[model samples]
Target: EPEVTQTPSHQVTQMGQEVILRCVPISNHLYFYWYRQILGQKVEFLVSFYNNEISEKSEIFDDQFSVERPDGSNFTLKIRSTKLEDSAMYFCASSVTSGEAFFGQGTRLTVV
Candidate 1:
């Protein structure tokens, strides 16, 4: 079966530092997205990418954040500057169509 894979299941960083979270989606999937869940909050949509461009984004994906598919197989999310409020479990997801997306286990990011 195909599944999304994220690296460094957990990460600890200092505030004001930059962090890059990575993911590899199923080979055939066309749409990719980034979602996050603060410790006690609901999962929130960050951004969605397709055809090498940003297809959609939520308020959370502000100027400080960016995403890329550096290689055809890998997708990444970068936070220009980490903040205490940025601590959360970030999930990478993908889907063949725009409907339901399959998510990676999630990468827990902690900023001190």
Candidate 2:
């Protein structure tokens, strides 16, 4: 079965540098989302995109973040300026509808 795949399962970056987290969402799904969990915290939604535009974004999705579908099968999230607080498990998810969301194993971003 097709599954969402995220690269560099763990990354350590400087506080001011940039990082790009890559993902390959399940093909045939129309909705894609990014969520983050800060250690013991709950999974918080960052943004959702469909039809090439953002469908919804939470307050956490500030100017420092961006998402794109670079090709037919790849999706990426770029953080322009990493911060210490950015350390968390970033999950890439996709669903045909709201009821069947699936998540990638997750990329753990660590900023120091």
Candidate 3:
């Protein structure tokens, strides 16, 4: 079985700076997503992509946030200006069907 992989398992950045979190979803999966968990909070959906375009996004996914498939294999999430509130465990997930998703170990982003 294949799984999702994320880079820089942990990241620390200054507030008001830019950060790009990277991930490689299962090749056969058709849907990709970005989600974040603020410590003790529930997992929050940020965005979902399909067929190379964003299919859905949450209010938390503001203009400061963006996602791209880039070359079609690597999926990435870019935060234009980091905020303290953005600090959390960011997860990259993918699924053959939207019903079940496989998540990466996650990137722990700490914004100072």
- Winning candidate number (TM-score): 1
Each candidate's lDDT (Cα)?
Answer: 0.97, 0.94, 0.97
In the predicted model 2, the residue pairs found to clash are none
The digit string of per-residue lDDT tens for model 3 on 1-112 reads: 7999999899999999999999999999999999999999999999999999999999999999999999878999999999999999999999999679999999999999
Q: Per-candidate TM vs. native?
A: 0.98, 0.97, 0.98
In model 3, what is the error at residue 62, expressed in angstroms? 0.3
**lDDT digits (tens) for residues 1-112 of candidate 1:** 8889998899999999999999999999999999999998899999999999999999999999999999999999999999999999999999998779999999999999
Candidates' RMSD to native: 0.5, 0.7, 0.6
Number of residue pairs clashing in candidate 3, backbone atoms closer than 3 angstroms, sequence gap of 3 or more or interchain: 0
Ranking by lDDT: 1, 3, 2
What does the lDDT read for residue 109 in candidate 1? 98
Q: Write the per-residue lDDT of candidate 2 for residues 17-104, one digit (tens) a residue.
A: 9999999999989999999999999999999999988899999999999999988688889999999999999999999988588999
**Which 10 consecutive residues of model 3 have the lowest summed lDDT?**
94-103
Candidate 2 — worst ten consecutive residues by lDDT sum? 94-103
Deviation in Å, model 2, residue 23 alpha carbon: 0.5
**Per-residue error at 29 for model 3, in Å?**
0.7
